[model samples]
Target: MITDTNHLTSLREQFAALRAQGLRARDAARKLALSEGDVMAAHAANQMHPDVAEHSLYTTMPLDSDWVNLLQGLENCGPVMALTRNDSVVHEKIGVYRNVSATGLMGLALGPEIDLRLFLSKWHAGFHVVEHTPKGEQHSLQFFDAHGRAVHKVHARPQTDLNALEALVQRHARPEARPVFMPGSPLRPPILADDRIDAPGLREAWSAMNDTHQFFTLLRKFEVDRAQSFRLMEGVHTRRTPLVSVQWLLEAAAGTGLPIMVFAGNEGCLQIHTGAVHRIEVMGPWLNVLDEGFNLHLRHDHVAESWLVTKPTVDGPVTSIELFDEQGQVIAMFFGERKPGKPELPAWRALAHQLAQGPVTVAQTEAA
Candidate 1:
């Protein structure tokens, strides 16, 4: 799903035109080579729950099966160790760490904040404290194993506390004798504006969605940008219009009746459902089949924005740098891997800059 700006732009227009032609969802999907199931899901979800349909379709996916955690009780819970791309953070657990899901991936669930820094690279017997900085737009960190193998990571900010974060990962765990602190982030979502999930709209959309596919479509439509872009993909061209951003994405997901699975990169992506927003679990880089999850890209009319993330290679430094969109769409592929001698400016910042390129001038309007 690596799309250049031109390709994305064309896709948007194509989707809009197809929709205008009153083509069936199947036709448009076929034209786009997208999953007819996905579109049908979106369409059906929209019909059933028009109000919150977008949110649901874009964010939720329930656990396919039961996740049984091996660790139990307060002992399993401890300090939450966080490793972001830029820095690391820690949180102490005031409560029990219920093993929900780690970075949205299922498998191991346990309560307790394990020091990812400790076990990420090598088995250090002594304790150490690592300071994480957020100054230069640094947002995430990855953890490595004793053999210098990268295993865990976290995206910082949204202001997560140690305890709160620890609780999130501690609850879900696999039965391992020694509890190694892993890197994690707290789910501190941003606030939302009124339009994202209108209370009334959520209620309305909830009732409308007849099936899961429809639910996802509506949810997918929650973001003004994503929706518009999606419409553009279906062939709706919202050239330079103010589209939804990540803030809106979260709010819509939270307020809507549907669940969400965030297929994210440097930015974000969500697979919505009728229940809750599920975080897609990252099993690591070698798990390429679903490794990158799903990809989505939006670029300026001209510039090909580079979206970057730390990609893991089978054998190399902790990670390799790669780029993708909110939807996991790889835009630019950087092969040869190297750990930056110095922290290079993150690719997400570049994306932020590119996405911000617009005609909006905040210069001269007099307030009434």
Candidate 2:
């Protein structure tokens, strides 16, 4: 095996060359068999100064720093884009980071334009990354977990308050030359045995669901995996939809002027977009919802299973289009936006039916 010194030297040299070729940090890190977080930390540790860092530079901070306070400080940065993603989906919302509140290891960004449910404890490494793209300079605050996967990232938009962003960077700066230490033992999520799954009780409990929130409790009670639960309820509450459902659903929503709720998440964060989507674009293997303030990028190829899911609630039948990755992990979920005490919009429910029916040509309507 190559020595540690030789490996680090090679990685550092190769990373520099890769960056020069117009590849983003995330792509370059993947090509070199390293985590993006590690590459950022390495360059940051070498700098040893915060103020000197500019666009295309890095400033590292202790992962255990006052994370809540640092995030709250971003409130002064008006009109920034809050981005969160998983292996299959990318969510972006441009708005002011406002109404930030934390309780223990959880936080919420309840801004009118930006909505997020943040898992604070998973944050293990933090960085203020400045990148110079073809358009212009990009300033962002990125957080990663112990496994070096990105938790969440906040990017300053063109109209963001630069003075406030600069102040935030200075306040949270910790110019240290120490390397990040990640613990061993990779994630190994155990699946409940097939015999152990309570097929009867699970079906009954699912049928009795009065709210979507109760679904989580049902999973905990049965100790069933998320995607497995969908399979269990196949003939009752949920049924599998074709892989093409995602693209068609978005187009149907766009044509009908129906408002929707698109939910995307990873371990550390959940980001949501609720409102009308005007543009549904499909390019190659990517399906995108490109509209004002909110954008969702989903890899259509990764949609191993798509479900037209329903749960009985007091208001009515709450429907959702849930897509899962191959490993039985949720990639993204879609629903008709609804509030408490209100039944699902008739328009949304109708469009959802089109997706579930499959192969039915829903006449793209322009509702009044």
Candidate 3:
């Protein structure tokens, strides 16, 4: 964190100027060569001089490091928006946080509206933020990783219980606490050579798998990267698709009125959206789903690879459209909506098949 009074002041001034130009916080921070968390931390109440008032743009109160309890408290703030995103996509759902439970550092939120898989260990710091937006006061709880990258966020909606939110903040706020952040780790090295992998054994394990949850175990057992595994089983279970496949899939689902599941996340959280998608819009490079309860903004240009993947389960074969970035990090995943013990939807299977067989015109790739 930049703690020097002179440096902090300079950062604030520059950030304010960028904000005046209508740049979002994340973009403004990046323009100043800083992470959003770094900028937020610099503006925290604890970091300010005792005689100075909070920053006019926003006020941030550091929250206690007890992530599990803080999140559980969100249950009282009904009908809030949960946001999770990676470099290529943003996933937002409006719902109440409910049934939050944690075992050690891993947690789960099983509410019908807010479904999340939480990796609490990556959650390094949190803050209760109140931004003075043009409309009015905007309240949110933002969590960040050790590298100052955001993991997840919850924003108050019109129906949210403001008193409960305020009480939760007051209970968890640590005005004197100073959160420290470290530089991000370097990029990982490329995957190992394929000759060293146990292809035959991997195939045997994949074929014998009884549940999709065991896919991670299979990867570990074979010591293969995810994309590599798919390449190895290309003809049997995986098919490489054009980048435009994602756009085509979404449009087809919307036209057919098929309910689907969309999964997108960063290292700290996995958020899922299930049901039908009605509104589909495109703006420049972004493909957006502007629905009432759910919204997805995906930067299709960032997609370096797309795959039609199939995994075996007790119920039947489940299919998904998975997208990856240039660094081989998963950008997002799509599946047909189905519950446990239920077979895969026939419409979804057909859609996946159609995606694989669809023609990839030069115009389609260029448009995407």
Give the true-structure RMSD of model 1. Answer: 23.9
Evaluate model 1: give its lDDT: 0.28
Pitting candidate 2 against candidate 3, the one with the higher TM-score is 3
Candidate 2's C-alpha runs over 4 A off are: 1-13, 45-64, 132-136, 177-185, 360-368
Better of 1 and 2 by lDDT: 2
**What tens-digit string does per-residue lDDT give for candidate 1 at 1-368?**
32244553455456556766877433675677653323322222212334533322121111111222312222333322232121111111122334433333322333332211111113111111112123333222232222222233333333435454345343432212121222233233343443554444443553454432353465445532322222222211111212322222323323331232222211111111112322322232211111121222323121222321222222321211223344323322221212235332233222223333432211211110
Regions more than 4 Å wrong, model 1: 1-75, 82-96, 99-151, 154-368
The collision pairs in model 2 are 56-130
Write candidate 3's Cα lDDT for 1-368 as tens digits. 68788888888889888999999788898899888888888878767765553445777899998888898999987899999998889999999899999999989998887899999989999999888777988999999988888999999999999999999999999988788877654366568788988888988888888799899999987889988888888888889888888888888778777889999999899999999898989999999999998999999999998899999889999999899998888999999999999998888887776688775333333333
Question: What local lDDT score does residue 25 receive in model 2, on the 0 to 100 scale?
Answer: 71
- Give the total clashing residue pairs for model 2: 1
* Ranked candidates, highest TM-score first: 3, 2, 1
In order of listing, the candidates' clash counts read: 103, 1, 0
Task: State the displacement of the C-alpha of residue 89, model 3, in Å, after optimal TM-score superposition.
Answer: 0.3
- State TM-scores per candidate: 0.22, 0.89, 0.94
